[model samples]
Structure formats: structure tokens, C-alpha cells
Target: MITNLERFKREMEPARQLYTREIQDFSKKYDALGEMSMEEFPDIDTQDYIFSFEKVNGASEEELDEIYIEISNHMEEFSRTHGIEKFCQNARIWL
Candidate 1:
């Protein structure tokens, strides 16, 4: 039987694709900045960039909250490790 988790995965596919494309585009633009080379940037693993929705549709609301909290934590860690402030500061005018 098709499960809710499976359904959620299917429903979220398009959004995932859009996010991937947008992130890649943003990364390219960020790389274009002459201040830092790609080597200087954090080596972001493909898995780290992916949002894990495993069993999410079947998860309880509390579990879902935990999942989002974990995601936010990871994002904050990535931002800190990769000097996101510098990027945001420089990109602020364009934004």
C-alpha cells in the first residue's frame, strides 16, 4: 500500500527540485565573487544539502518539530562553518 510517507515524498518532489536548482544557482553566483575561491569555501556534501523527509508524513507533530529543529541546527552550523555572514553582507545590496 502506498503510505503517507511515500505520498509526502511524491508531493514534495517538485519543491525539492526547485530548491536544488535555486541553491545551485546561488552557489554559482557566490563562487563568482572574487574575494574567495571555491577551495576556500566549505566542502558541502551532497547529502548534507538534501532535506531528509524519511517517514515525515507518518511522523507525529512533535517528531516533525524535532526534524525541523535538526534541519535548522544543521543550516546554522553550515552557515557558521562557511562564513555565511560575509556572503550575506556582500550580497545584501543585491538582495
Candidate 2:
């Protein structure tokens, strides 16, 4: 029988694929901008960040929280290094 974890993973697969594609597109769009500082991209909206994942049917609250935290941390670092606009622009998961 399929486990809960397995089912959850299956449900999240589509969102993950979408996130990857969005990020890649954002990277390409900004590739010509060159290294930009945080101040350069002042329109970044962190309220609805990309890494926020919808809860899977069988996933526990704890599991979803962990996933969000992991993604948030990674995205935070990425935003700091790559600018918040780039981060927000590529954030299609929550969009």
C-alpha cells in the first residue's frame, strides 16, 4: 500500500515542477542585469513569498511546517544574494 509520505510527495510533485520552472525563467530574465544589490530591487513583496506550499491532503501540520521553514530559509538566502525582486519574480508556487 502507498504510505502517507508517498502520497504527500506525489501531491507536491506538480508544485515543485512549477517552482523550478518559474525560478529558471526569473534567472534568465535577470541574467543581463548583472549582480544587483538589494536596494536596486525595492519592489519585492515578501508577504506572498514563493516557497509557501499548500498543505497536502495527508500531510501532517508538522510536516508542512517543516517544509515551509526549509523552503523559506533557502529562499531567504537566495533573495539576499540575488535580490528580492528576483526572488519575488520567480515565486510562482504561491501565485
Candidate 3:
């Protein structure tokens, strides 16, 4: 029989791994965007953008814009205070 602590650890391990992976992926994307390399940026795959928007089907454009603005403001604050590295590090906490 698995001990309670062992069971809990096993359950939490996957969540932690997933969170770390997401954090790393977001950091990479953020860095890629910050480079402002036109060749690389706006580089988010169109299909991914489409899919993301589709996931939020029915969201008004204004509502989406507001959300984007809010996120941008938060990112700006993080960038100013902690820089990208720490901002991305803290993103996991929010995620």
C-alpha cells in the first residue's frame, strides 16, 4: 500500500512538472517577442492564435481588447520591477 505522503507526492509531481513546462514555454515565447525581430515575431503561429480565440468564442472584441490591455499592463509592471527572467519566474505563481 502506498503511504499517504507518497501518494500525495506522486499526484503533485505531474502538476509541478506541467507548471514548470508552461512557465518555460511562456518565457521562451516572451523572449522571442521581446527581441522584436519581425522575422521571428508576430511569429505566433496563426493557427494557435485562431485556436486560442476560438476557445474564447463569443467574447466581444472590446472585451478581448480589455483583457489584452490588462495583461499588457501587468507584464509592463513585472518587466519594470523584476525584468523578464523574474517576471516569467513569477508567472508560474499566477498560472
Candidate 4:
């Protein structure tokens, strides 16, 4: 059976390609993953996604801040382990 999220997405954006990331291993639980609206017209192969306050849909400020903190931590860790290297492909964002 189709879930509400799946059904809403189908009706709202049938032709759009979506990429999802599971909320995992951030500094804290930060489990704010749900119903994020597409914030930009994607350049599908771009190295990173940019979420903006201007484009925010139903998400709260805390949820956005959680994302920022997790990304900041990831970047700090990445620079420590692998400085300025694009270790993974953009397609892994889909995984």
C-alpha cells in the first residue's frame, strides 16, 4: 500500500526525481526528516544541496538548524580525514 507521503508526492510531483537521505548518526537524534519541499530547481549533479530559509515549506527553524549542525559536523570531520577531496560521487546522495 502507498503511504501518505508517497501518495502526496505522486500527486504533487509525479515527474520530478527525488533523492532522500535518512537521518542518521548526526551529533544528536535530529530526527526531523519529513515532508521537505524541494527548495530549488536542481542541477542534478551538483556536489551539494542548498536549503534556504526563503524557500522553506512546513519545516521549523529548529529542524533547519539541526540540518545545519549535522552538515557542519560532517564537513569538519571530512576536512580532518580528507582535506578538500571529493571522495564520493554525487549519485551517492541518492542512496
Which candidate gets the maximum TM-score versus the true structure? 2
Any runs in candidate 1 off by more than 4 Å, and if so which? 32-95
Using alpha carbons, what is the TM-score of model 4? 0.31
| TM-score of each candidate structure, all chains considered together | 0.34, 0.36, 0.33, 0.31
Each candidate: what lDDT? 0.37, 0.42, 0.36, 0.38
lDDT of 2 by residue, 1-95 (tens): 86664554455445445445544444333222222111121122222223323333465666545644554455556555644434344343331
Cα error, residue 53 of model 2, in Å, equals 3.4
Task: Pull out the clashing pairs in model 3.
Answer: none
Encode model 1's per-residue lDDT on 1-95: one tens digit a residue. 86665554455445445443433343333222222111112122111123223232254666556645544454445445654532322121110
Candidate 1's C-alpha lDDT? 0.37
Worst 10 residues of 1 by lDDT: 39-48
Report the lDDT tens digits of candidate 3 across residue range 1-95: 76654554454444434444443344343311221111101222211001011212355666656644654455445445543432233232211
Candidate 3 segments whose C-alpha is farther than 4 A from its true place:
1-55, 85-95
> Measured by TM-score, how close is model 1 to the native structure?
0.34
Candidate 3 vs candidate 4: the TM-score winner is 3
